[model samples]
Target: MLNYGILSTASICARYIAGVRESKNGFVYGIASRNLENAKQFAKKHNIEHYYGSYSECIEDENIDIIYIPTMNAIHYRWAKYALECHKHVIVEKPFVLLKEQAIELFELSKKNHCFLMEAQKSVFLPTTLKLKELLDTKIIGDIKYINLSAGFPGRFPEGHWMTDHASGGGALYGSCTYTVEFLSFLFDEPSYQYDAHFIKGKGSADDVVHFTLLFNDIIVSSVISMCCALKNEAIFYGTKGYIVVKNFWKSNGLDVHIDGNMTHFDFPYTSEFVYENNHIQECIEKGLTESPVMNKEKTIYAVKIVEDLYKQM
Candidate 1:
């Protein structure tokens, strides 16, 4: 069994702990935080076996075979690099890093250290997403022409939240647009794409709202993401003979496909998408794989590049 160690007490950590429990091949071995009491409390609450007060201590523990990082966006490169240096496999939450350079560097380090590294992008691992890809490959939707996707939420975070701090990698592009970019990259193979973006900055240097149009192999895609407003939270793909509309697409819950004026619906009953991601991590480790086939390094780098380019345009 792969013993998993978590490096933070972030809200996302709780969900990960639950996911580990659901994965028979792994368990939450330990948890760490700057605050010892917080770590202890979290460990006890989740039935984790050990707790540490420092991230370094947790990663250095020889018993931990994998480290799950769900920390701030800006710190991902740092923690991921450190974990790799300690020869531990890592699974970091997405938007992998603030810059494409960091993503490249981390992947190199993981290879040098001969350790596994994966981005915890639940969308790609979802059954619904896999089904969507299968249908597309079978030409269920015919020739692709355009895509419209929007994902966002009304800003409710208090001041000084990391989601509002640009230096901490806060912004709609980093926060929610990762999903859109992943979808586009998944649907289309061409990494060469052109895009134009507009941003609305909020209280901090980060853009609360980001709108963009992209062209991938002649397929036009438009997306709007925000932390200041609520959008339709959907992705619509228009094809020559039919179309597919997914409500709350990122969640991988359900989708509707229309062909020749006939509508067919698909619903995923699973609650926690992280469970699938957790299983994938363990399966990779068991097979002596250094990277996930589903969320591979090339595609992850492509996704990050899209985010980086959009920011540059803004």
Candidate 2:
């Protein structure tokens, strides 16, 4: 079995850890956190074997072959580099790093170490998202005119909360919009953001709302993302013949694909699709592949560029 070591006790690791435990060829052997109790709790809850008080200790575990990093956004580059330097493969949470330069360095480090690295971009792995790709490629939507997507949520983050702090890379655009931008870039093959507009947050140190337009090969895509507002999540593709409406862009839910007067509803059962990604890690390791096609360094770098640019503008 492939052994996994989680570099943080963050909630994001819980999803993938659960998936890895359920996979026949994968398992999370250990978890590390700044708080010893936090690491112990996370490992015990997941029935994992080891709990390390420091991230360095986790990476030093020779039994662990893969490392999952879900810490704060700004620390992504550092932690990923440490993991690769230890000769362990890595999977980092989205909004990969704070800058494209950081991403470039991590990419080079992974290659130099001959270790696999990928961004944990969940959208592209969803069944609905997979279908969207086929539809767009076949021109099922017909003469794509525009694409609209938005995602946000409300939370009571206290003062000094990373979400509202600039140093922590806190903001709605990084935490939420990264998914939208990454998927759009993937489906449309790296569309250029020709037109841009946005609404800056009145309180937070980072962007709360970002409205941007991207030009695809032959289509225009418009998107608006906000964190201060109420919950609103959707990915709408407008085309000459029809449009596809994905209501809940983050999770497995019902999405509609409309063609002319006919509407097709997609019912997706919410299980641990995150684990499916862990399976990809296992397959790559077994076959000696250094990167996952679904979440390669190129896509990760592209997504990082979008976040880096958004932050620069904000």
lDDT of candidates 1 onward, in order = 0.85, 0.78
Clashing pairs in 2: none
Tens digit per residue, CA lDDT, model 1, 1-314: 88999999988898878778887698889999989999999989888879999999999999999998888889989999999999999998889887889999999999898899988888877778877887777888888889999987885666678888888988888887778877667656435678889999998888999888888777899999888887888989898889998887877688889999899998886757678888988888888888988788987887788888888876
lDDT of 2 by residue, 169-250 (tens): 7776677666877787777766666545565774757666677666657677777766666656788888888999988775
| Winner by TM-score | 1
Measured by lDDT, the strongest candidate is 1
Please state every model's RMSD to the true fold in angstroms.
1.6, 1.9
